[model samples]
Target chain A: MGQTNPLRSARLGSRATDQFYEDLRQGAREGKPVCWILGALITTPMVTSLGIPWVFADALAAHLAARHQQKRPEEVAEEKGYLRETCSYTRIHMGCTLLSEEDRSKVLDWQVPNPDFVIITDGCCSEWVEWGDDVRKRFKVPIFTLHVPFLWNDKDRDEATNYVVGQLKEMNTFLEDTTRRKQDWIKLAEIINMGRQAQDMRAAGQQLCRNIPAPATIFDWATALGAVFNSWGKPQSVEIYKSMKQEMEERVARKEGAVVGEKYRLAWDGMIVWPEFGPLSKKLASRGANVVTSAYMWGFFPTLMDPTDPLKSIAWNMVDVWANRNLDWQINHVAQLCEDYKVDGLICHAHYTCRALCGQQLELMDAVSRRLDIPAIFIEADVGDESFYSEAQVDTRLQALLEMIDAKRKRRA
Target chain B: MKAVAGVDIGSLTAKTVLLDLQGQLLSYSIVAAGMVNRKAARKCLTQAIRKARLRTSDIGSIVSTGYGRSLVKFGDRNITEISCHARGAHWLMPHVRMVIDIGGQDSKVISVDSEGRVANFAMNDKCAAGTGRFLEVMSQALAVDLAAMGTLSLTSTNPAQVSSLCTVFAESEIISLAARGCPTVDIVAGLHEAIGRRVVSMVKGVGIHPPVMMSGGVAKNQGVVKVLSQLLKTDILVPPEPQIVGALGAAIFALEE
Candidate 1:
């Protein structure tokens, strides 16, 4: 199904103008606080700074929101319908939601829109957001926006750091000048410091686990410590980290039964479905495959990390740990998920234009296949660049893969 | 009467150079690679042979370099661009110590020893942001061809500031500038300055000394070369045909081997 522009005005020309006026009046009369549910990836920070109480939905929020949009069983048949509509990992989490409608509605309404002062800060492609103009209508506040580029090349670490710091400084100046209000630079500094600390703790944990026996338990402990440090002195962050850990543990313990007729459990790694996640998920389900786990979903686990020994962690993680641990962890984490999920195969989507993500696809696929003895099909696709993909070619290749999986299963049986 | 042929098939163009046994260039030919490596190599070879007024068998040995070096199936040997470039620069100016070859997809700073051998080298090939591709993309954004950029940039009395070093960000930066009614010349000069800064930093990272030679397609961009020379606080030597340096080096290598 084609996406009707979410922000498009219904009528063209003067009709749109009239509709906009009508919207403004309705918004004024209702006097509801403008609420913005910010996607929590990279975009969260910038949005949150705009005084929007960003909806703190992890991968689950995006998934649930996508499912809510797709209101029919047939809609679930096409992978592109749900999975390709949003980020796939988010869609999957949202699809797995056991929350009651009432509770979900409350969660959705968590933003207090009155006086329109809720901001969300999350990481996404650069930092950007889409919100209703109701807040602007009600409060007449300008939406301040700041976008960070998503490229990460540590080889150019000095240059990248200088660039980022410069952008941040410029953004700070813009915020102060535009709003005629001084930002809490202290808060920004604290968050940055905490982020760096958390990064360090996670690094240390990664190194400690590498040469040790009982690696998983050690890593988990290290991760939990890192999460605690990452969420340091922030009640909301602490609460979210606690919930995430509890949820992860519960999910692991419950070991949900395989869907009735599901034949293969697959794990996806890296970015997915910027615009077509809904359709992609439905397509996969039609093939009787379940993506039980993904790295993107699990990768956010470190966001919760906080450490007692931040300096120590940073030293170990940033200096002593393997230079590519950040990427390597994602790959290894996905491999671990495949094993834990008892997945039959893995599909590693190497998106074009995302050199950082795509760069590791070949190496990850090779490593995963060698370690697990599972057939890994590495597919190249763009997250949003539709021009690079051929649906027919992909479908043909997928069908052949499913057949190969079936033959392998039958032989095992 | 002996002559050697060198072919450097880069990502965007193919260059072939003919050198007499005395290491003097007899002739050279450069043409677009046209997205087909094999055909581009053949075209380059044919053009060079015709230009040199000699048949294919007249060449004693053929050496290939650049990204598409292996595509030259007719070549006697394939040498890495780094080695070939060093040799080529050495042949051009025996006193030259460092050779900076900035190609379309990759850039390198080659530190040469006294004997024209690669002593220490640094390369940035994983990203196109720091190469001639960045300039090409900027040219399109600025509505100019590769050739016109240098001359147009020279007209800028006060170049517009370009902050982003990343290719995508830099393009968007240019777009935003154009949207704000910034002049084309200023933007072009800004781009040249940015690229020059990037190249200078790369060279500085590997420790650049005097008598640095700049080669590759980007060497044709006088704007970048001017800014680069200013940044380095020294003169940069550009051969008569800068793009053919890699091929010239390869041919020199063929003779030595």
Candidate 2:
């Protein structure tokens, strides 16, 4: 999946992921104040403005898992009485904390240094706040918690955004105090503008996939997202997205799909199965199914962020996302994607250990299937747990989806 | 272009079906899917071709299906067993709105529309619980013949409790019941009831629309069917030869090809 892609950003994205690891290791050696944060609200601007290194806990877990290096971390977490049912990313990150000196050297590619402080948000799930508190206790680090209310009414959007924006102001003081450096407000504005350009380029790249033969597969976007997520607000991210958008334009002009024989255009939900990423992509491409879009990738990245009023814009973007809404919001979100992508089927990865992310997958599949009149399959997987993945199950379910699509085509004919 | 063939290489058996130009079943054969399913696929297709008194060259197209569908190198195309089972079950009983396929190593419940197109499907995770393999293992542990367990269970007055979902644990639980002087019929009946409960619960979760047809190797077991029928509160329909339905459906597709 990696080498086969003609997209330059895919290659650069891999380098960007590698650079992320290198930067973390170098930052630790230099004793930079690193904060492990949950919720995507403060990741980009906070790190860029303060001129300090930061760790996004979930991203590191995904990095570790993708490298086939999460086994010992899982073992350490399980030994510490963290049930396998607890989020695998949480276990992987926490297990990194509990790793013995010998195990850490063997397991981790780069040392995951202890955080100077913790940032927790209940915007997505309360579980993050609890996991954040546990991290706070483990290292005796202070925890900064922010509350973003769940919205059932579209009218509550402004209220939630305003509330979260107020908290972001307090967060600036906390960052300044933790790092003993003043927050660079001017730098924050610049980074936020840069992030907006990057997001637009990436979104434009994704939009090109609505073509008959999708010029870029979701795997292409998902692969490059490693760099995009690692450096969302940085200059390099803008270049990465620009390259990706250009590749999509070139491929569409040439009538070349990332998947050679695109047949069934499908949408995916839940976390990407990081451990089996390449093989998963290869297998689907073999079946002529170009999975063109995902709710996970589409919903997580902010579509719009006001650089002028950075916190208010980020807060508004955060509250209106799929993760923060009810089941109805999620159902409509995916249905709209299906129509937009011309997707005839859906694959909802029912990640086994994702308590926060996976509860409504079955219901989501059912509602979307009925509402959109498309077939949906929920294949069991764990986002970071390689051992929990079953190739047979994945093969059977996805094959069934293709067959369903074929049958529908026949009936229409 | 007078006939088409379908080969289904499953976990336990490889089956092949041949259909004539008029879309009538000509002949079919089932053989043990040995360690090499590729070999079994070849043998099964050959046997079905010969049984129909037709040469290999007569097959207009070959569609392979089941878990080992990819291994059928001669297949012109391959469809997953889920779609094949739905198509085949509908061909056999057109009114069926659902098909419950419990094979050797896996089980799935497929919801279909009035026209028999697949609407939705749910399958067990990578586990052998609620499948024919579980019964085969339990029969071995209880020293009961696999085919006769169904009849013997029908004679039980009070069934023993067999609650473990894992095959090994369920085997141990049944053996423990036997150790305590529980009747073998009671234990066997309990195994049927347990597997019935497990599979029916799955069907219920998928929201069963009835006129349900049961297919795959497990359909041959009367006790499991009887128990499932009771739990689902619907009389289940079973084709004369259940395991060949997937291959039958594939052959149907080959006719269209």
Candidate 1 lDDT by residue in tens digits, A1-413 = 11111101101212322332344345546653333333323323332343323333332233233334322211232243443434332333333232345544534422222333323222333222422132334356655443333324446534433544455555556555654556654554454455554445444433322221211221123223223222323343433334433443343355422232355666666656434554565556566665555655334434332244322222222221221245565566667867766767777776654454566666677678668866566455655434345543344334434544553564568
Docking class of 1: incorrect
**What is the C-alpha lDDT profile of model 2 across A158-245, one tens digit per residue?**
8888988888888878888888999888888898888889888888887898988888877787777764567878878888889888
For candidate 2 chain A, the 10 contiguous residues with the lowest summed lDDT are A1-10
Model 2 misses residue A53 by how many Å? Answer: 0.6
- Model 2: lDDT to the true structure: 0.84
For each candidate, what's the DockQ? 0.01, 0.70
Could you estimate the TM-score for every candidate? 0.43, 0.93
Worst 10 residues of 2 chain B by lDDT: B111-120
DockQ (model 1, Cα): 0.01
